[model samples]
Target chain A: MPTDTADPRYDYALRPPRLPQPVDESLASAPIDLDVRLEMYRKLHLLRQWSKRAHDLFLQNLVKGTTHLSLGQEAVAAAFSSAMRPDDYTFATYRGHAHSLSRGMDPGEALAELLGRKNGVLGGKGGSMHLTDVTRGMMGSYAIIGAHLCIANGAAWSAQMRGTGQVAVCFFGDGTTNIGAFHEALNMAKIWNLPVVFVCENNLYMEYTPIDLVTAVPRPAADRAPAYGLEPIVVDGNDPDAVYLVAREAIERARRGEGPSLIEAQTYRHGGHSRADPGKYRPQSEVEAWKARDPIPMYHDRLLKLGTPEATLTGIERQVAEVVDAATEFAKNGPEPGLEDLLVNVWADGGAEWRN
Target chain B: MAELSYREAVAYGIAQEMRRDPRLVMLGEDIAAAGGVFKTTVGLLEEFGPDRVRDTPISEQAIIGAAMGAAMTGIPVIAELMFSDFIAVTWDMIANEIAKTRYMTNGQVTLPLVIRTANGGGVRFGAQHSQSVENWCMMIPGLKVVAPATPTDVVGLMAASVRDPDPVIFFEHKALMATSEEIPDGEIVDTLGTARIRREGTDLTIAALAAMVPRALEAAEMLAADGISAEVIDVRSLVPLDTRTILQSVAKTGRFYTVEENPRVLGWGAELVSIVSHEAFWDLDGPCVRITTPHIPLPAASSLEDLAIPSVQKIYETVKRTIGGAP
Candidate 1:
């Protein structure tokens, strides 16, 4: 066993040392295409704008219930979604709008859910925290910090047992590292060598407390993975291209049955923890410094430098704007779930007895 | 019919289920290699191999949580929590997740999981290892709680539990694990909610569960010797209790006595008495009688523990008084 002192770079005090630039250099070196980069940039921008709209609606009392906004962590979801196959399973934490959008869930349904409209993904029963679309392989999102880790582990175990090459990804924040469920799920996943990618969107603050104060071992949360016999990778979460390349590699490794990997994406949340927080715990200078590394603008600049026409990007933005607007309108008009719907799924009616 | 011990019946049922369904698996600590702490799962690992009969780490939460996850994804898992007392550590996953998943998910998911754990306090395993929580599980709406007293009942109820679509918590009395009885071959017990009439009489009705069933039967025989005909009724399923059988028996006898190996207050005996009082209040000639372990936790010394639990003499005296035999 290698001791902590053996690797001086594995520091607990300072910020995590960034992985070598372009962790997947071969994939990054592939032929540059203008249209693909423009499309990616537009999708990331749409998520940011849509989150802002939802936040405003929440402030105006148009949306009811709690909503965890992922304003700054858009790139992690966008990159991972871009690398995933349509059939693969994905589970997320309470801040799940980006995950839902990335997995191709209707923006209209997403908006309606955020606005507490009847036509939401869960028929308005599960608000932002509980949005799900099984058809799109979005297994569901949970409010419990690390509870979904077990679910994802179970799903991956199921897929392996059934001989399906499909992989499952569990998305959680740095706060989840402190939970016992997280440790149990990770150990089981490692022992069984299940196909799971644990994506830790380390936004540094667990609600109001900073990660340094909460975690005894102050390091990129991923570095703790080796204790469970897993190789950990730290990536620049602010850069979409970097996140995409690393996520693709991790996904491929899991699909190949190499077991689970921990990818700690060092990112920041631009908004408060939820609709109720003003994010007063964070320093103004730190917020501005992170904003300068905003993934959408960086990817937009890279695409333009690669000869992607501005008109094409503008056209994609217009399409995203229309979809978001329509979803918002649809949610406003969607019917509320009736009281009868509540008791409908309580039991499975078997021929003689209820069976699953 | 063959003579079988209570533990053998449990093992036989599990072995039969493992042979019947390829997906039925058993998991627990030392269950595979050591044949279980009580030897209830003897020779299973050798018969089914490590995959089906798995040995787990000493994590009660993981054992139950993994079984829950497996149950959700098309597997019928029989997870053993070494002692029923340890269930408190994993109650969140067991009660909240496994028990409530079906109701919470609106029936989209069914947890076909059987949590088998040993309960009761006669062996003097002290306070931590010896507590009967069947009453606690009985309060949950979606769960089925069963405590079998005899070998035949153990085999029959276990088979029924494994086949049932919903989650079942099978509580086996550690003390009764050694008792032997005749179990009929190919005898399939139907209607888990129905109570069995272990002894028939006209003077008074004695209702008991698990280890208390034999004690109730012995008390009835003693009563019979004293000219008091006490009918012993084995209340197999606690949650979906056979209230009809109990009420019918009470109606005929005009008196009822409930015995349990649990604490007197808020125990299964209290629940049985409550049911009879509510349904057969007019039929009762005397107040419903209950013989249960004292409210205090089971003591470490065997002598004190014996006094704390209900015995045959206690049941006989309780029954005699219920039938107006003496003060």
Candidate 2:
């Protein structure tokens, strides 16, 4: 009620209706099997718990640098990652730990990177914001807003040019949709028929500023998609099954050479934008509401109601704790990079001219 | 050997590289159907078709970023900005994304990417379009800056740049694009960390890059008229600089002077002065002089623009003064 729906500044009129979650269809009728469902649940749970641990480390001053975690938005990462092929490429925003984890990047290496160790990915060259794993198809995580859109387009273009059926998915927040690259990349993708999916994680905030205050349209992905001559989809990002089904459609469409699509995953970040932010700008009642819809417990209760054994659910939780524990211990003991490692990978021919 | 202009040599070099490697592609505004505003990419679209020879929209950041992504994903791309002036829009992608991708990824990516753009300020293209940004790029690490003045060096350096495993910013002088030279038979790819001693002398070592090379050669001719022998060295590649050749020349001459189209303060020539001072300072007979553009933006008017940049006359004066004696 605080925001006026009739305001011309906000594009409430252009947005599509929100997709419902926990549809009438039974769990047996879902696309994924019971085993995959449990795995998705386990990954989402692990992501939530891992984010908590990372926050604790930041607070304890153990972590040297700040990090952006998708604290409340784990299901989107789990669902879309499970939907796509392993060879498919993903370009993520700064809050990409969950997405990287979903793409099978080892937690040990990620933690080591956080610890700035020799055993870390990039050998401590790229800390929290710049984690990359080409082997796992998480090409790179960009910290700049709207910087990765065209990069994703080029990857998808390469796939089409090389006769590879792989897809490229760019994960950004609602704030990034306002930038110029969003329009330019989408127009080019439509013209070239690139196999890319532009997924906007609609967390309703560009840092502390509300999306409505800045964005012309309420649903940027849908409104902007039509401008670029494509139909866009919206899904409940917190619901893994709903998100999974929507992502599957988009991925398969791109794989079939039907060109790119945009999907706005309506989700929320439970924590602040970064470690330094307290998220004081958000209304208190809204935060409590999203917290009640937290994906981990919601999915757990839904699975238990669908005849899943309590022991099976408990065992999944235990496994996740073990993985997080091992990752932390490994990262703590990892070797610090030597001075020589600074010059590595700078050039393929030889070492670069470094300042002494 | 074939006689070719600098523009023709670039197109020919790219075509040859494309023939040798199918992964090589070109992308930039007006490069495909229009053959580039400078006509440097003429006839490429017809030969390679639109896929390999792409004409991008006027999105400098997107085009540069897309090329970096494509290069990282296993294809070699030559992304051209219409002018070096527009490179300000591409600094982030160049300095942060393309240049640092290979190193930041921990050796996971290899970017065989070359960025081509016309530089210098002879034509009256106004302040926005006229700038020699080779110095602007030289400050960044992990990038090879090549300014090819003649037709042959343009082809040779561009060919070498495409074959290089790292990112290279290949600067072609706008005023020298139509200038012709003899390109040798077979492939003429030269080593990057090498300089050409155009005219060797003992009075003063004159180092210059791109358009300045030709001016230095002219200055050498003028200095010869006055009985002053000036060694003219072409500083072809700025990064992975051929400091040894320069040091050896300065050791022999015992005096140094540098000329560039960039502003004098913190110019590319200033870097040469620093290096020569550091390595061969003891051998120097006098202080090194840097003949360059004034500390101001290039003007659009013909007279002002010409007055702003270094000329053969100024080079002559600086060389004589660095020797600190009348010839």
Binned by DockQ into CAPRI classes (incorrect, acceptable, medium, high), candidate 1 is: acceptable
Model 2's DockQ?
Answer: 0.55
Displacement of the residue B264 alpha carbon in candidate 1, Å: 4.3
- TM-score of candidate 1's A chain against the true A chain: 0.88
Per-residue accuracy of model 2 over B1-327 as CA lDDT, tens digit each: 889998898898898888889888889999999998998998999999999999888888888878877887888889999999899987777887877777777888788889999898999997888899988888888888898878988878888999998989999889998899787899777778788899989888999899889999998999999999999999898887888888999999998888988877799778889888998999998888878899998899998988899998888887766577533
In terms of lDDT, the best-performing candidate is: 2
lDDT of 1 by residue, A138-211 (tens): 76676766667776776777666666788888899999988877888888888878888999999988887677
All candidates: TM-score: 0.86, 0.95
Badly placed stretches (over 4 Å) of model 1 are A1-57, A60-65, A104-128, A342-344, A350-356, B187-192, B201-204, B251-257, B268-280, B283-286, B322-327
**In model 1 chain A, where is the ten-residue run with the lowest total lDDT?**
A347-356
